[model samples]
Target: MLIPYTVKPRPDTGLINSKLGIWLFLASEVMLFGALFSSYILLRVNSVDWPVGSTILSVPIAAFNTVVLISSSITVIMAWASLKMGNLSKGRMYILITFLLGLTFMCVKAYEYNTKFHHGLFPSESTFMAIYFTLTGLHGLHVLGGMIVFAYFWGPGAKMWKTEPEHFTNRIEIVGLYWHFVDLVWIFLFPVLYLL
Candidate 1:
């Protein structure tokens, strides 16, 4: 038997099962990050000397990563849109681009981490470094996770396009929501952890 409300919205909730599930997941994610952000603020406010973000972090690198993430957000949307428009090949191209952009962002983050480690800076070095690493590291992990999901849809999961087009599109839409949330978090983090 087939599941109800997988593609169509449930009358009471106005969202499909996958969309509702993603929003609930994102809500919990928001709470987790909010608590961490509040802790960062409390730590900074109570500290005697919080290192200036620009002096400690590479602003240029972080800014570039920001662009990369924003680009991925656009590409993921395009991928979903392409699928909705009944263009499987185009959708595949957009998803591939999104994955590559995510990979690029990760590489840049790795480089930034390597530079800091080479300079003998670590999360344990100071309160400022600790908060910085904690926030950005968590965000990076989210990016990695999104990439893996997109990669799956791009590869083996693409078969769903022929077998269950609406379900496949819904999957992409759900993943796109998660990807946009990840990108949005980085948008907030870039300034808080790198520019400020």
Candidate 2:
């Protein structure tokens, strides 16, 4: 006698295990980021001389990236809405746009990091530079991860708009959650690190 397995796709449960698992994952991510931010606050209060961020960081560039990231959130929403309406092509188009925005985020981030290094804002500069690098680098890695997810979602091999539309919808929602978190963090970072 052998145990039987049910591998049938479960669309009835509303995107099956994807959304549930993604939410759990997102919750963990929130806690992880929360710790980082808390550490930033604690260390900031301890430092007598914080690195001057305004002279080092380019607010114009970062502000532009913020807009791009926020716009990607809109793109993901459009994709999800289109999928709900059974418009697979439109959904896929919006998903592709989201991926482009994610790519733009990475490109601009890489350029900014390079500029910081050129200005002698290395890890050894001060405690502030260390915090800056760690926070922004973590955020950049999240952007990279989003790009990876979007690459799979938008790829022809994924059959996103064809065979597994519900699965695609779940993927979009998870990506959207991650995108919104990224944008929210940047909102605080921009004013604190760039403006203040």
Query: Clash totals for all models, in order?
Result: 0, 0
How does each model score on TM-score?
0.97, 0.86
Per-residue lDDT of model 2, residues 1-196, tens digit only? 5211112335666434555666788889889778988988898889897766777788899899989999998998998899879887798788899999989988998999898888887978887788788888888888888878877877863484476666667667767887777788788877877776
Per-candidate local distance difference test: 0.93, 0.79
Model 2 C-alpha RMSD vs. true structure (Å) is: 3.9
Per-residue lDDT of candidate 1, residues 1-196 (tens digit): 8768988899999989889899999999999999999999999899998878999888888888999999999999999999999999999999999999999999999999999999999999999999988998998899999999989999999999998899999999999999999998988998888877
The runs of at least 3 residues in candidate 1 whose Cα sits more than 4 Å from the true structure, single-residue gaps closed, are 1-3
